[model samples]
Target: MSYRQKQLVMQYAEINNVLDFRLKPELKEALNNIHKQLRKLDDDRERIYLEYSQKLA
Candidate 1:
């Protein structure tokens, strides 16, 4: 990979790890709420991402 690509990949990984650690509890709570609200939904991953993205925006 190019240097810039490598740098961006590393930065993304670091940010993802930090966000994972810092927001894990809140993410879990959001997931639980989503599950409760939409019992028929089968995709937890997408649901969590959508919820978190909405919250971040």
Candidate 2:
């Protein structure tokens, strides 16, 4: 990579190490809850589709 690109990447890594932006417990829990809700919605969608398809057949 070019020198400027290398510098920018190194700067980003240093800032990330200092900040640790993705390591908050509340943020992680919120993400987990959203994931669970999405999974439930997907399951419900599949179940309803199957039920309707069976009825129409």
Candidate 3:
């Protein structure tokens, strides 16, 4: 898996970890922020790849 895939896997693990409600509110907010950033990263990666492939074509 690539770096972003690894990050997504780790994020999945983090989500599982939080499912038990063991984290504090601030920590939960931070995790949510991380989730948002990761999603944006994924979106940006897709856009970049599309642009790159078009350039190659």
Candidate number of the best TM-score: 3
Candidate 2 colliding pairs? none
lDDT by residue for model 3 over 1-57, one digit each (tens)?
268767876875776577556555666676777778778888888999999999999
Candidate 1 residue 3 C-alpha distance from true site, Å: 0.4
- Please state every model's RMSD to the true fold in angstroms: 14.7, 13.4, 2.8
TM-score of each: 0.31, 0.59, 0.61
lDDT of 1 by residue, 1-57 (tens): 245445545554554565465556665555555445444333555778799999999
Candidate 1 vs candidate 2: which has greater lDDT? Answer: 2
Candidate 2 C-alpha lDDT tens digits along 1-57 = 245445545554554455544665454555465556556666777899899999999
Instruction: For model 1, give the 10-residue run with minimal summed lDDT.
Output: 34-43
- Per-candidate Cα lDDT values, in order, are 0.55, 0.60, 0.75
Error of 3 at 49 (Å): 0.9
